[model samples]
Target: MNKDLEKLACKDLIDLALLMPKKFDDLRLNDAPILNELNCTKVVIKSKKQLAGKRLTCIAYSYNWECECTITIFNARPFHNALFAINKELLIYGKLNDFAGLLQFVNPKIIKNSGEITANYMIKGVSDKSISEIKKKYLNYESLKAYDLLDEHIKLLLTMSENSSDAMLLLNSDELNECLKFVEIFHHIRRLNETYKNDTLYKKLKTHDINKWLKSLPFSPTNDQLKAILDIKSDLENAKHKIRITMGDVGCGKSLVIFAAALMTYPNKAILMAPTSVLAQQLYEEAKRLMPGFVKILHFSGAKTKFMQDELQDANFVIGTHALLWADISDASLVMIDEQQRFGAKQRMRLKELATTNDVNPHYIEFSATPIPRTTALINSDIYSYSFIKELPFKKEIETKLITIEQSKELFNHIRIENEKNHQAIIVYPLIEEGKTNTYKPLESVIPYYEKHFKNVYYTHGKDKEKDNVLSEFALKGDVLLSTTIIEVGISLPRLSIIVIVAPERYGLSTLHQLRGRVGRNGVKSYCYLLSKNEFSDRLIEFSKTLDGFKIAEIDLANRKSGDLIDGDYQHGASFKYFDETSDNIILQKAKEYIHKLQDK
Candidate 1:
């Protein structure tokens, strides 16, 4: 029997029993059962040593009979962390073994004082006991009814549930209950492996009116756009009431797909929401131009007047900013969201509230250029149905290259020649607006750059109200656009050929795709220059070497996961911070499981 382990209390004894090999009989009191397991000594491997000629040569040493088998090896120095220097007693657990006739203990676990185990120490080693440690901290669960433990914010809003479905006001409880009921009902009614017969007007265009629209268009919808449209259409048709989420590359014509759907669902009210006023206005004008029947569009933004909000209520296909959320939407049936992930879960839940009433819930179609990490988890959990449009629209090849300051000079010379040949170019930097104590390049105040490089150069940033107007002019009449990433979406001009992004490594993959998207609208041979000055620029350069947007996206998503803002951007309203994907998922799963067990209790 291990003497050191005898000192452990009942709780620690149980922990040891749970962790040790089953071959070791359970510890019993007063001559109860068989007990052969010893408190084994922990030996840390100082360095990789070959077992040669009946001996293992190393600084490492193992105790013949020490309990609590925990040993830590430090990578910094040989023999480092192998043993306590001050002869501090440790409870070690391991089996003695002979390797090449030399004694060793291959695996060991430690039972030590809680205070001695720092957070950093616990994280460094991988052991079977990790599960127990994790269950102990970071999780405090109790039993309550599913309805009882609902977040307080949700509960407070639920009380006024009568107006829950009204987008203008936050949801009250009745509205939330109504939405929950509808979701439950829809979940029951949802069909599997279903596809809708293109009965909508958008489907009509595909068969009859599409050619006309296609013929009228100077540029065709990229194959990617068509696929996305079809995927969204299928989701709309298959679900009991369409509930589909679609993701695509930036400038992938997501709005066009929405417009086509709206056209097909005409005479039926469709309400589209954009996160920002600028995006909302852009969507509204584009939808109206495409559908063209006195569209009766009302835009509700923070900037809208009371009169605007009042009139917006009756619009058939009202589109606008969050202000649209304030408009009464009792009659609006079809709900669509652009940049859906930008809003928090609470905001999105509000949208769901607006789309439902006590009796009926509107079908929802969510659009995102950047797919939230939760999308996959949701799909895995059978929470949401999904479809993807992964293909690009055109075959015209665009060369994407990463350039440094020196490389950018040569690229600039080439761009200059292209500009002289009547083509336009865009040079993008990270900072859209000038700052007081700035570190990033000022894309807006680049007068010195303009004078040094080109005959005529224009700048546009997010802060500028004339951003769209300026970008349009630059694409049409100007020789060069020395600008920021604001032109990543929706703006189209065929003559604008080259996009040179400064400090490309600072931008997300989605942002880069959008920037590249700005010029490829016309299927012309476009060029994208990725510029950076950081160590990470090597990765950006490697990414630029590939023209495949999806491939770049995959790499970017992986790299972004390692950043501080990774979880901050997604999981809106989620109180928990994520340290790692696997850890977070396991924690959530365990929490949910605990809740379920409590309910069972």
Candidate 2:
């Protein structure tokens, strides 16, 4: 790569082609000058130039208009003085300004050749000349064709890079925008295709009677959950190794799908990794109750490692926390991760590697309770197989509302009423300890007040060592739980009917949705109060209207810029500059078709 091109972040021909000009200089000679607009005309220097301080003034006669105009150059260099020599006929381009009654040209540029256009780039440390040269060398048909771009796309890029009159027209047209969007998506997908591989061998699981297993379940599986299980079932039966993600809203019954996948791979071992110990314990208990007695199930976490070695030998289904990453295990035909975004890339990969035997990678399926926008799922589907479960097993009756400090009495009375019914409430604070500049009360200061006013008040945060125990106890006996957002993703509190988020504006809509999901479990009537100083926040107000996590994700995307959605290994960084994931679905669909056509060739 050329150093100058590297400075502009151009790694290849495609990148160089996409480097569009910031502006274009039209130097075509005009028959008549348009006032206050850029014009180019042949002019004759009429008088000797006069220098005042750093300014130079001269008179020039426009041959086309047959008028003499005052030309002034500020901070004139030696080249400016030479260009305006007396009696010299030259072509000059500048904004034709009419000051008061006199026509004037300020710092007019001498055009060596008229009837041409020049591209002006804004790249720092790289001159326009260098960019032009790079474009001329690499922005040709043959160069871009090597990257498998469609011929029409290559031509459009060439026209844009040429800086012609047609280029200017295309710059303002929607056609160019569509073409750029297609190119970006096409390039990204192709890059992923080149690097993505599924060469690892895997033993195909024999077909099992999943429908019969579903019949024995206590409750009927929703259509979405059944479809997701079927999707995973198909992947397990295939000879090729599989990678799929099952995403859904909170309480969408993704757990049943996990167990179904494990059952499908029965006789062959299956393993699941959860984000927290509490979640792992909950899943272990659920598996024991729901799974049939024939399947041997084992739970592994930091606390239960003493007997893991002996238990692993014949364990048909293993569920554990991050401690499973370091455990010695083998011969697992399938691997599943819950809340996949919570685990790092290395941790997930480590668990998958532990299950691999004879270089055969286990079939991997990740479950996400954090719902993403449909458009993002569509775009990402080109890289990984996706299954979305939108239907909840039961309707959640969560009534969300925005409240202010003045409404404290009303909020407290509501909590008291819930407590009278043997229901529980949780107050989520933004911080554990009060900061010097904090505007809202922290958990430390508010816990004492709750302890004084109410009974069975419990508090915990991310740094708390006994958080798992606290959450377990809170689920059984606590009336009110005062804590931070640590309870956002774990535990199933059946009696949790009310959740009050302090300073709700400090969190993203998706996060706020996750916190709101803590309540309304078991289909009980619940309330979510957004305890904020500013009650009229449009985001919170809009959030209070719907219980759809997917819709909240869309709203979050609309409210935030790119690169704020997911973190850790699942993050799709800001790779597409022109493709708007929010509104470019049509273009993405077209690009997928075009790429498929090219693949057929």
Candidate 3:
């Protein structure tokens, strides 16, 4: 790679080919020059005269037009005087002007050749000549062929590299942009495959029958859940290691799938790491109730070290928070992470490393309730296998409303009625303390009012050390809970019937969806109120129309014009130069089809 090319962040042949020119200079000879426009013509210097202030004036005779034209060079140096000698044959290119009815060329440049167009680049610290040289070396048929690009794409890029009329024709065509978008996605998927192909399983996992266990369950599993289980079964039985992400909507029974995976890895051990201790305990309780009594299930958190060490040796399924990362364990064949996006990459990698031994990696699976758009999921399927569970175990009936401060009396009355029914309500504030720019009351300022009117009021924030305890206590005896967005994921509140978000317009649609999901967990009537000073918000209005998290994600993507609403790690900083996640769905589909064909071969 050239040092100058490296400065422009060109990493490969594809990158070099995609470095499009900002503009092109057409120096082709013009037979008929237009007045007050840039023209190129062959000319001969008939006479030259030096003026005051180092200016030179030359009378040039144009061969094509058969006319004499005036040429003026400002601040003319010694080279300029020498070049414009008497009767010198040359090609001049510049803007022709009519100064007082006289045809003139002001500061016209001498062109060595007048039949070819030239490309001009706009990169800082890199000259146009250097960029042209780099392109000539890398953006060729042979070089692009080595990267397995299609012939059509390579030819289009080659034409773009050359300075010609054909290059301009292709540059303005839609076919060229589509080709570039396709190649960008194709190259990204290939790189991701190569990066993930490094690890393999030492041996295929032994299959375990889940039919008997399914029959033992109290209710029938949804078809999506069954399919996800089968996908995991196939991955476990393969010699090649696979990493799969199973995304489900809120209260979509993902815990059942987690339990099923544990059942498949019965004799061998399986481990699940959750983000919060409250969620870990919830899954632990569900596992104990659902799984057979024969399986040894253990829950580890901030408890004593000796107790955890003793149970770690023989436990079939261990569920815990980040405390699981520090525990010593070996020979585990499966690792599952619930709410996988909550943990950093290093934290997830550390948990996976604890289970890896004998040069064999465990089958990794991530479970997330953060739903994404279907198009995005399809695009990312090239990198990782995905299973979506959009079907809820039970249809949720939640009334979402947009409210204002003028409706405070009605909002307070609704809260009181829900409280009178022995149901719980939660109010989420944007901040803990008031700031200069705050338009709504902070949690601290409003705590007094809630405490005076509502009995058994509990409050917590993300930075509170005892938030877990507070949440647990609130779930048991509290009538109202006040907190930040920390309750966005993981704690199952069956009795939570109402969730009022102060300044709801300040949050993303997906986040509002997740927060709304906290209610109506157990098929009870629930309500979500969006309290804002503004009477109307398009995003909030759209969010209140549906309870589908995936659709909410699409709306959010459309409003933000960014893919960062999805997992941040998968986006690679959302820095795609050509591929637009918002509007390039068709191009992505074509690229995926092509890559699939190659994989089949």
Candidate 4:
């Protein structure tokens, strides 16, 4: 064994067995000496000699056969001449030929060392023949039995390689290959999850403490929210270094979970980092009002806070925007990040590092409003503890509609009627001001038309100086707010009833789902109108039928190929390397269950 192979990450025979081949070739001998079949035979070179210019020829016999097996080796090196001398015994594996009145082996790999197979393991950037030998030595039914994996799944795994005695009888070659793919993917995910062992770091959370805090709130938590809190609570209680990512639809009441996390980590200094000032301010206000008064909560955003810096540091719970990444809150034992996708890999990892102490990492919880596929959530389990709040706490009555340029008049009439009812309306244009694209009308171009029809019409975009104030105004007294997708997160507009998106095809379904979430907070019938002209309109039309953001995520999975998975930026979504997140949930669930069982053990 070389140093490189000895250092391979394989812990035991199971690792060797689980290294599935990217492909397999048939080298099995036929019942008889059938021509055109790849065969392996033991032979003695009866007449062997070097020909012109590295060409070597040999006549070999196997199994006391009368027919001579002619072997012509091309580009023979010096070692080949020494090894294939007259009367030397050899094992030849290659394509068998019936060219003339003779049986022949062409370009055969003379197996001086049996079980040696060339393979590319990918991790080492080098190829090794010893891998085949190792697989042969250790990859067996008993080796699988030692791992304690699901019996059915393991049987499926071996059947893919045709290792089971009756596997081929049950499945044809094509069927086996197809089913074997699931097996290979199952192992790939299993190996990724196995690395999470031995990394638990956190103190147990008391449910009674959480119950006491819940009593302080005016409203009760949703069952899904409570389930999420319980999962987080269990993780906090069991591990020292906790990593959990909470994903839910926008307006699914994730703030309660964030506040609950802070309350659960009471007296241990919980710090929260939100993506924007508006969201940070909103969460800060919620925490201050909902949490126990004696807990001492503070908000810091954009600059040094009005409160004394020491007070900010010493507070039981602190909420801030990106300013939190640099805030010196070393007493922090729990760190929660809101709208975590707004930050890149460097910033998220930096917060984790900053919150961490010398002995253990702070229990980290990340909150995202983007709903992801269940398999995607499972894949992410390799790095983060995943929890989903898909069931809405409050029923959102938003009905989606697909409209085109021709339907502009009816759309305007609906907005006019909604506004006349004192119900607020938002028209979200793709562009703040039209520049490059001509297909979509910008806000500046259309505001005049909207202002002419509706009263108290105001407009704002992401760069608006008074965007928060504008949103505040629209939520209160304004009848119509013509804007961009700036109101996607954190604004609770209970009166806003309709969101009309122009050129809706330009935005992903997730963003549109968030924009649609702005309405229907108070269970009033809310409407989402998607205006587009391209053939891409069908997706938006399909999107309008369901209100489930998680279902929209499934459509997103099929429409958009996944992005990078390396940096943990699942916001744009990381592509699955092996399994299809859409079709492979069964395997994903099994892998998750297997890894979770291991963690428990």
lDDT of each: 0.53, 0.81, 0.82, 0.71
lDDT of 3 by residue, 14-128 (tens): 8888888887778988878789777899999999999999999998899989988999999999999789998899998889999767779999888888887888778888887
Better of 2 and 3 by lDDT: 3
Worst 10 residues of 2 by lDDT: 564-573
Q: Which stretches of model 1 miss by more than 4 angstroms?
A: 1-242, 248-253, 275-279, 292-295, 341-347, 369-384, 388-394, 432-440, 465-468, 535-542, 545-547, 561-601
Q: Which candidate is the best by TM-score?
A: 2
List candidate 4 segments past 4 Å from native.
Answer: 1-198, 203-213, 240-242, 247-252, 305-309, 340-346, 373-375, 379-394, 536-538, 569-574, 589-601
* Position 481, candidate 1: lDDT: 81
Q: Supply the global lDDT for candidate 3.
A: 0.82
**lDDT of candidate 1 over 516-560, digit per residue (tens):** 766756677788887766555555766667655546644554555
User: How many collisions per candidate?
Assistant: 27, 0, 0, 6
Candidate 2, 1-601: lDDT as tens digits:
5775687886567878888887788988888878999889898999856677788888889998898888998888888778889999999899999976778899888788988888888888788777887788767788889988888889999999886898877885688888888887777667655433455667688956777879988899999999998898889998884368888888989889999999999988899999888888889999999988899999886777876788887899999888888777777888899987576556776788888888777898888766444224433537567798989867889999888988989999999899999999999999988799999888898777899888889989999999988998888889999988888887898899999999998987767888888888789999999988874667778889988766776676656533522222344345467888768878878878887898788
TM for every model, in the order presented, reads 0.58, 0.84, 0.82, 0.68
Can you list the residue pairs that collide in candidate 4?
201-239, 201-240, 201-241, 202-239, 202-240, 204-237
Q: Which of candidates 1 and 4 is the stronger one according to TM-score?
A: 4
